[model samples]
Target: MITEESIQQFSKNCENIFTQIRRDVIGQQEVVEGTVIAMIAGGNVLLEGVPGVGKTRLVRTLGRVFDMPFSRIQFTPDLMPADVTGTNIIVKGEDGNSQFQFQPGPIFSNIVLADEINRATPKTQSALLEAMQEHTVTVMGVSRKMKEPFFVLATQNPIEQDGTYPLPEAQMDRFMFNLIVPNPGLDELMAIVNMTQKTMAEVAEPVCSGEELLKMRETANQVPVAEEVMRYAMTLCSATHPNSDCASEAAKKYVRLGASPRAGQALISAAKVKALMNGRFNVAYSDVNALAAPVLRHRMKLNFEAIADRVAPDAIVKMIVEEVGTRFGLNPKKEEAAAKAESKKGLFSGKKA
Candidate 1:
C-alpha cells in the first residue's frame, strides 16, 4: 500500500531529478515533463524534432539524473536485428570444446536511447517492438528478459526524410507518448549557448534509484479517479475515431484512423502521475485534458484532406477534447453550482415554474 508519506517523497524525488536534468538540458520543458511522466508510468517515448534541438541531450540528461545504466544505439539502415538484440557466438570452452554463447546487446540496459531511430529500416525497427511491449527479447528460439524498469527513449529528425523509414503503425502504438520537441525561444537559445560555451557541460547527478522510481509508479497507480472523470477520458478517446458516435466534426473530416485503446490507458496513467505531481490525491478532468496531445498525436492518423489543408494532428486532438468536454458536461464549476442549488431545494420539493 502507498502511504501519504510515500507519495510526498516520490514527488519530492521527481522534482529533484527534474531540477538536476534542467541544469544540463536548456529548454523544452514540456518534452522533459512528458518524458518524466512516461518514465514513471513505465512506458516508451518517441521524440520527433529537427536535429540539434536537444532531443538526444534530453534523453542523456535523463539517464544521468536517474543514475541508470544507459546505452545509445545509433540506428542505421545497415543495422541488423542481431545488432539490437543479442546474438549467439561460438566460444572455446575450458576443455577446448566450442560452444554457442549469447552475448547481450545495448537493449539490455536500464535506459536505452534509440538515437535517429527512423534512420533504420523497418526490419531493424521491428526488432524493438517486442522489447518495448513485453520487456523480453526472443532470439534464435531463446527468450531473455530485460532488467527491471526498462525504458526506450527514441529520437527522430522530422525534416530529414529522404533516407528515413516511417515507423510502422504496429511499432508506433507501442509507445506511450510521441512528444514534439520545439525549437528554443530567444532567451532559451541564449541560455543554451552560454551553458555550452567556454566550459564543459554540467552533468546531472542521480537523485533517485531505479527502486525508488518503481515505488513512485506504485504510488501513482494509487491515485483515484472519479467515474465521471474516467468516462470523460473514454469519451475523448472514442471521439478521436472517425465517424464514431462520439467523434467530433474534425475527426470525421480529417482523421483517417483514430487513437487506439492504448492511448486511453496512457491518458489515465499519465493523468494519475500528473495529479500526484500537482499535490492532488484524485485525478481532475484537467489532468486528462492536459495530456491528450502527447498521448494522441501519433496515434491519430490524418487523411489526405488534412495534409492538403496542412492540418496538424495536434489541432484535431484539441478539437476533439473541446467537443467531448461539452458533450460530457465537464464544466466543474458549473456542475458544482448546480449540485449546490439542488441541495438547497431539498430532495422531495418540486421546482417552482
Candidate 2:
C-alpha cells in the first residue's frame, strides 16, 4: 500500500537523481528532467539533437547517478541486428565438447544508450523494438528477458539525414517521449566552458540504486487519476486522429495518421509521474497538456499539404491543445475563455487559479 508519504519519498529520490545529473550536465534542463520522468515511469525516451549537445553525456551521467549497468551502442550503417541484440557463439565446455552459448549484448543492461540510432539500418533498429516495449529480446527463436528497470535512452542526429535510415512509425511509437535538445544559451555555454576547462572533471555520484528506481516506478503507477482527467487525456489523444469526432481542425486537415492507443497509455502513465514530481497526489490536466507534444510528436504522421506548408508536429499538437483546452469541464471554446480568465487573475493576484 503506497501512501502519499511514499510518493513524496519517490519525488525526493527523483530530485536527488536530478541534482547528481546536473553536476555533470550543464544545460538542457528539460531534456534531463524529461529523461528522469520517462525513466521513473518505466518508459524509454528518444532524444533528437545535433552533435555535441551533451546528449551522450546526459545518458552517461544518468548511468552513474543511478548506479546501474550502462551500455553504449554507437549505431552505424554497418551495424547488424545481432550486434544490437546478442548471438549464439560456440564455446568449448569442460568435457571438451563444443556447445552454443548465448552471449548477451548491450541491450541486456539496465541503461542502454543507443547513440545515433538513426545511423543503423531499419532492420537492425527493429531489434530494439521488442526490448524497449516488452523488456525482452528474441534471438535465434529463443526469447531472453532483460534485467528489471531496462530503459533505452536513444539519441539521433536530426541534422544528418544522408545514408541514415528513418525510424518506422511503429519504432517511433515505442518511445514514451521524443525530446528535442536545443543549443545552450550564452550563459550556459560559458558555464559549460568553465566546467570543462578545469583539469579535474566532475563525476556524478550514485544517489539511488536500480532497486530504488524500480520502486519509484511502482509508486508512480500507484498515483490515482480522476475520471475527468483520464477522459481529457484520452480526448487529447483521439483529437490527434483526423477521423475521430473530437479531431481538431489542424488534425483533420494536416494529419494523415493519428496516435495509437499506446499514446493514451503514455499520457496517463507519464502524467502520474509528472503529478508526483509536482508533489500532487492525483494527476492534473496541466500535466497532460505539458507532456502532449513529446508524447504525440513522433506518433503522428502529417499529410502532403502539411509537408508542403512546413507544418511541424509540435505546431499541430499545439493547435490541438488549444482546441481541447486545459479544464475540459466545459466546451473547448468556453474552457479556453475560462483559462484566459484564470491567467489574468493569476497575473493580477500573483497566484494561479
Candidate 3:
C-alpha cells in the first residue's frame, strides 16, 4: 500500500534528482523528465537527436545523480557483439595450465551509455535485446544477471543516415520511451556555453542510490489507477492499431504498424510515476494524454504515405489523442459548458421567432 508520506518522499527525491541534473544539463526539460520517468519505471530509453544536443551528457549526469557505476560504449560499425557482452579468454592457471575465463564487458554496469547506438550493425545491436528486456547477458550459454537499478540510455543521430542502421522493430519495442532531444533556445544556449566555460566536467553530486531508486519504482507501482482511466489508457493504445476495434482515423490513415502490448504496460507504469511526481495518489486521464507521445512515437511505424506527406509520428500521435479524447468525453466540465451554451443558443432562436 502507498502511504501519503511515501508519496511525499518520492516527489522530494525526484526534486533533488532534477536539481542535481540541472547542474550539468541546461535545456530539453521534456527529454530529461521522460528519461527520468523511464529510469524510475525500470525501463530503457532511446534518445534521438542530432549531434551535440546533450544526449550523452544527460546519461553521464544521470549516472552521477544516481551514484551508479557508469560505462560508455561508443558504438561504431566496426564494433562487435563480443566487444559489448564480453567473451571468454584463455588464461594461464596457477599450475601453468591454460583455462577459459570470462571477461565482462561494459554492459555489466549499473548505468550504460550507448552513444550513437545506431552506428552499430544489426547483429551487434541485437546483442542488447536480451539485456534490455531480461536484464541479463548470455555468453557461451551462460547467463549473468545485471546489477540492481540497471538502465541502458542509448542515443542515436537522426540527421546522419549515411552509414547508420535503423533500429529493428523488436529492439525498438524494448525501449520504454523514445524522447527527442531538441536544441536549446538562445537563452539556454548562452547558459550552456557559460557553464561549460567554467568547467567541462560534470559538477552534479549524487542524490539517489540504486537501492533508493528501486524503492521509488516499488512505490510508483502502488499508485492506483481508476477502472475508467485504465480502460481509457488501453483504448488509446488500441487506437494506435488501425486494425483494432478501437482504431482512430489518424491511425487508419497514417500508421503502418501500431504499438505492441508492451506499450500499454509502459503507459500505465509511467503514468503511475507521473501521478506520484505531481503529488497525486491516483492516475488520471491527463497523465495518460501527456505521456502518449513519448511512449507511442517510436513504437509506431508510419506508413509510406505518412512519410511521403511529411507527417511525423508526433503529429499522428497528437491527432489520435484528440480523436480518442473526444470519443471518450475525457473532460466532462468542457462538455457541460458546451451543452449549456447550446441550450442558450436554442432559447435565443426561439425568442427571435
Candidate 4:
C-alpha cells in the first residue's frame, strides 16, 4: 500500500533526479519527463532520434539518480545472442567433477543502455526480447531472474537505417514509450555548452535506491483509473484506426493500420502514472492525450503513402488528440461519475465517456 507521505517523498526524489540530469543535459523537458515516467512505471522506453541528441546522457544521468547498476551494449551486426544473455561455461572443481554453470551477461544490470539498438542483427536483437518482456533469461534450460527495477533504454538513429536492422514491430510494442529527443533550442544549446565545458563538474549522486523505486511503481499501480477513463484511453486507441469515424484526416491518409490492444492498455497505465506524477490520484483525459504520441508512435504503422508523403507519426497523433481531446470537457472536479450524473439531466445523457 502507498501512503500519501511516500508519494510526496517519491516526487521529491523525482525532482532531485531531474535537477541533477539537467546539470549535464540541456532542455527537452518532455524527454526527461518521459524517461522518469517510464522508470516510475517499471517499464522500458525507446529513445528514437538522430545522433548526438543526448540520449546517452539522459540514460547515464538516470543511472546516477538511483545508483542503479548500469550496462551499455553497443549493438552491432556481429553482436551475438550469447554475448547479451550470457552462456554456460564448463568448469572443473577440486572434487574432480566437471560442471557447467551460467555466467550472467550485461542483461543482469538494473539499467541497460542498448545504444544503437538498430545496428544489431535481428538474431542478436531477439536476445533482449525475452528479457525485456519477461525479465528472465533462460540459459541451458535454467531461468534466471533479473534484478528488480530493471529497465532497457534503447536508442536508434532515425536517419541511418543502412547496415542496421529495424526493430520488429512486435518488439517495438514492448517498449512503454517511444520518445523523440529533439535538438536543443538556442538558449538550451548555449547552456549545454557552458554545462559541459566545466572540467570539474560536480555531478549527480544516488538520490534513491532500487527498493524506493519499486515502492513507487507499486504506488503508480494504486493510482485510480476510473472506468470511463479506461474507455477514453480505449477510444484514443480506437480512433487511430483509419476506419473509425474518430480517425483524423491525417490518419485516414497516412495510417494503413491502427494501434493494437496493447496500445490501449499502455495508454491507461501510463496515464495513471502521469497523473500521479503531476500529484494527482486519478487519471485524466488530458494526461492520456499528452501521452498518446509517445505511446503510439512506435506501435502504429503508417502506410507506404505516409512514408512517401514525409508525414511523421507525431503529426498523426496530434491530429487524433486534437480530434478527441476537447470533446470531453476538462473539468477537474466533475469526474466520470459526476459527468454521468449530470448527463442524466441532459437530453443526450452527455454520452458516457
Q: What tens-digit string does per-residue lDDT give for candidate 2 at 1-353?
A: 67867876786787678667777987676677688889988889999999988898888888899988999999999999999898999999999999999998889899999999999999999999999999999999999999988999999999988989999988999999999999999999999988888843658899999999889989988888999888888998999999998888989999999999999999999888877766577887777777888999999999999999999999999899877774365355554454344334321122322
Model 1 C-alpha lDDT per residue in residues 1-353, reported as the tens digit of each score? 76979977876787687778878887676788789989999999999998889999889888988978999999999999899998999999999999999999899999999999999999999999999999999999998999989999999998887999999998999999999999999999999888889565667889878999998999999888999999999988899898788888989999999989999999999989877765678887777887888999899889999999999998898788777878887774554454334323321122210
What is candidate 3's CA lDDT for residue 58? 93
Q: How many residue pairs clash in all the candidates, one count each?
A: 0, 0, 0, 0
Q: With candidate 2 superimposed using the best TM-score fit, by how many Å does residue 17's alpha carbon deviate from the native? A: 0.7
Candidate 3 lDDT tens digits, 1-353: 88877777787788789888888898776788789989999999999988998999999989899978999999999999999999999999999999999999999999999999999999999999999999999999999999988889999999999989999999999999999999899999999999988899899999998988988999999999999999989998999999999999999999989999999999999989877775568887877877888899999999999999999999998888888888887664553354334323321122110
3 or 4, greater by TM-score: 3
Collision count of model 2: 0
Model 4 C-alpha lDDT per residue in residues 1-353, reported as the tens digit of each score: 76888778766766666667666567777787778888888778999888877898788878887778999999999999999999999899889899987888999999999999999999989899888889999888888999988999999988886899989987898898999988888998887777777753547778788998888778788888888878777877888889986676667888988898878877877776777666578887767777788999888789999899888898888777766655654443334344334324321111211
Residue-pair clash count for candidate 4: 0
> What's model 2's TM-score?
0.92
Worst 10 residues of 3 by lDDT: 344-353
Better of 2 and 3 by lDDT: 3
Which is the winner by lDDT between candidate 1 and candidate 3? 3
What residue runs in model 4 are displaced by over 4 Å at the alpha carbon? 200-202, 243-250, 326-353
Candidates in order, TM-scores: namely 0.92, 0.92, 0.93, 0.88
Arrange candidates, best lDDT first: 3, 1, 2, 4
* Clashing residue pairs for model 2: none
